[model samples]
Target: MASEPPDAAAASRRDGGRPGGLRRMLRRLTASEAEIEAEELQRDVERHGCQPARQVERGQLVSVTGRLRTVVYTPRTTVPTLEADLYDGSDVVTLVWLGRRQIAGIEPGRALTARGRVAIRDDRKVIYNPYYELEAAP
Candidate 1:
């Protein structure tokens, strides 16, 4: 890897001021040029339109705008799970907060945002179910 110049205004910088950090990482990841170009185009397009995100025929980005209708906390389990009933106004999503790092942070009725890939669990659609959690409202 080569060193990049110290000019902060030059553009995005990575590594030792080298040009290859982003490109090399992209190359190593085997990202397609068209995909990269599309991403760049998407970045430009992002400022002009609503954000694009992963959605189930059922789910959307877990944001603070959702309503909190339920919460369950277990105390006897080896690892606690914070189960939340998140409503996106139209319907509800059941999100599970697993692991001490996240499960410890959940609270009932707190406005939250959780972003993750959505999937069908127990035949119902959920986002951040096994992966999502209660994100503190900023």
Candidate 2:
């Protein structure tokens, strides 16, 4: 029989009708983790300050050196493609080698420098058939 106050109704709507305290705290914690991860990524990219991957522009010929974070092979497609995600502290770039299943020495945890013109594919930055040099393990 009692009616909710105007402010309580507004707060409930803002919190999606859930109690705000714990839910808000959890949301804040999740956001903090994302912020920390992004900061770490930026710092890693900055270590290679000479050729920062974040500054690479579309269609610009660039030489970026970074550690391979992931290596994926897509053989189901008409053209087999080897895709690798390279991270240089600052940004992540996807490297795609079409018509190839694998390239020797191109694997996760490998350090490599790739030279190519930057392109955007599927809303992600990518380089196709880049000339790459595998770095000596440190």
Considering every candidate listed, which one attains the maximal TM-score? 2
- Candidate 2 structure lDDT: 0.81
Q: Against the hidden reference, what TM-scores do the models get? A: 0.41, 0.64
Runs with alpha carbons beyond 4 Å of true place in candidate 1: 1-55, 58-65, 75-79, 101-105, 129-138
Residue pair clashes in candidate 1: 3-17, 4-16, 4-17, 4-18, 128-132
How far does residue 63 in candidate 2 sit from its true spot (Å)? 0.4
Error of 1 at 80 (Å): 3.4
What C-alpha lDDT values do all the predictions have?
A: 0.51, 0.81
**Can you write out model 1's per-residue Cα lDDT over 59-89, one digit (the tens) per residue?**
5543322435677865545767666765543
Q: Against the true structure, whose lDDT is highest?
A: 2
* TM-score between model 2 and native: 0.64
